[model samples]
Target: MMLHAGSWRELDTELYSLTDNNTHVSIVVPYTAPDTVFEAVQSDSIRARVDLLLLETPNMWQLNDLSLACNFPLTMTECYPNGTVTALAVKVESVRNLNPKYLTLSDRSCKPVFSNDRFAFFSFNLNSCGTTRTFFDNVMVYENEIAMHHSMGKHQSRKGLINPDYRHTVSCYYLVNDTETMAFRTRPRNSDPKADPGVGQLVVQMRLAQEVSYDLFYQTEDYPVVKYLQQPLYFEVELMRSTDPRIALVLENCWATLHEDRTTLPSWDLIVDRCENLDDRYIVFYPVVADARVHIPAHVKRFSVKMFTFTTDETVLKEQIFVHCDADLCDTTKPDGICSGQCASPLRNAKPLKPTGSRRGIAADISQHRLSSGPIILSDSSNFV
Candidate 1:
């Protein structure tokens, strides 16, 4: 008998069966797991993962996904079916990790009434009620790993890393933190007058967990001129994995400081794209910032952004970290030429949209965090975090 649009599919134990328990079938799927998302979640740093399937289905139709038992049904309008593809993501990150009953679906936020006792690759099929076909040739599965530990500690302290003698062959000074913490800064505190009287100071707190197994992407020691993004922007960060399922890698208390007034950059929307684990050494992380703008309309020349990384009870969370360096190293005349090469950037290819100035960084007005204007058009003055 031909399975109609609303017909339920049987258990699939064959090759394309995405569920760990071989629960249901998702017909017309082109690629299997490793074939598509292998490299994405192949990092040891990734503890979980789910496929972000980009799909193009029949015009003005919804998906008839029968992978899970009681899947909260979903329908798509294909409103602008200009050959456009919608998404049908699965919560496979918790595949074998969680009880089958608690599985999640991209469409249904609440648990389904008839959940399959297994894990399924978020798959979409033709609706039994409708005759629209769902085609997914190109797909992507993003990995979202989180830090289960408390705040990652700072290995380099201003007092501990200072040297009296310093010299340089290339640039005068080096950046305190890498891209990992590029968007991090602390709020202005009246207590420390000498330590950056106002805002715009990137907190120099490096988390020393090299052995913790998380891949990081940062430009060379020579930092980018602090660019401002007048438009909203998003960033990615790899996080340490959590051993326990209940504890999610969560981020909290995030805001940006304007350069001119040292005020907070209001948040219109902060989205946590993923909080699951992938089987990769490093998880691909992305967050959505609908509006990365200030409450006021004034154009910002400089600013500092701030956010934190840690584990919490929330199902969806993101992470970020930053650190400060010893200002004493800036003198360029400190001790046994230690600060010279220590602060110099290696001879690598020129950075994208390299800053014209030879300044240390974009935040020149502030203390050691020498920031300069660059291409990304980021909000400015003294942006941190």
Candidate 2:
């Protein structure tokens, strides 16, 4: 007899009764197994629910116990201005049976730079590793796709096929550094016997704080990454000079732009004329203070802004944002110091500083320069809460 469970079975029985000389056995079976069908449907629904849960919480799955043991953290070590090349480094686990012999950056083999019992390091040049370069407005971006190939010696066996390889990609942006040559003012046709003192060299550096405390920062990573509309970004801009103690750093204006060119259209003002932008309620300008451990000078300026992106009617440009600041070195000791401690608004008519030759004191000799920092990438909002 055929059973509803998709199997055939036979059963026999003997009657041992005086009244029952002959007996017959009858088997009954249902057309379908209702329990089995219900179980299959329930299992499919459970699988669908699990898939939906994974989709909703993607990061949770990444941190699950079944995740791979290795991690890949790619970082840009240095960017050569002259050659337009960038150096990148990556760290990976150094498991005994899962050790990788070498890494491939865009198909170019890169030997391990350093190795230890716990981790192995790999370094490569973006330009020489078959990297692809693209231009976004005035910014130049380089992308390198890297892969790790495990050592074939241990993986030669058929069981080795079970192990998985690792792959990751990172993009590096090229931006002008803080060091800039001073554009000295020209001597006037009619000037005093004492020639005008040339504006000395001034170096400006911008850094991003790693936490809300605004103390620890990613000083090495020139290209910092931030989350979208999740956390506030703290920035510290410092002016370095050794020529004169009377000189003070003044940030005239600061703004954010989608492109590398600060003059590009669709820019958002962070600080205008030494004052925070009134339109952005999330902007907070921290008082300038000295921190010797972080190399922050006593005349440093710091500010924090909530993460944001540039939007337009056509489309929302969320690739990368750059921060640019127009700063000047002012002689504070002068009687008529050009560095007005207040904002330049309609109510306050602050006179512009005259040319170095026209003004008598060094206060008028303003060394104005534009400093930039970024290619700051905003993480996808879906990645976070």
- Clashes per candidate (backbone, < 3 Å): 61, 0
What TM-score against the true fold does each predicted structure earn?
A: 0.15, 0.39
Candidate 2 vs. true structure, TM-score:
0.39
Off by over 4 Å in 1: 1-216, 219-232, 259-385
Q: Candidate 1's residue-wise lDDT over 1-385, tens digit each?
A: 0121123233233634343235443433332333222112211221222232222244524333222111223331122223322222222322222233333332233233443433222222222111233223443212211111211137534433323121101101123333563566789897856654674322222122111221232333423323233222233221222122221122211122222221222111111111111111121223222233322111111112222111124211132212211121122233333223222112233211211112122211112321211112233434534
TM-score of 1: 0.15
In order, what is each prediction's RMSD in angstroms? 35.1, 31.0
- Residue clash pairs of candidate 2: none
Candidate 2 CA-lDDT value = 0.52
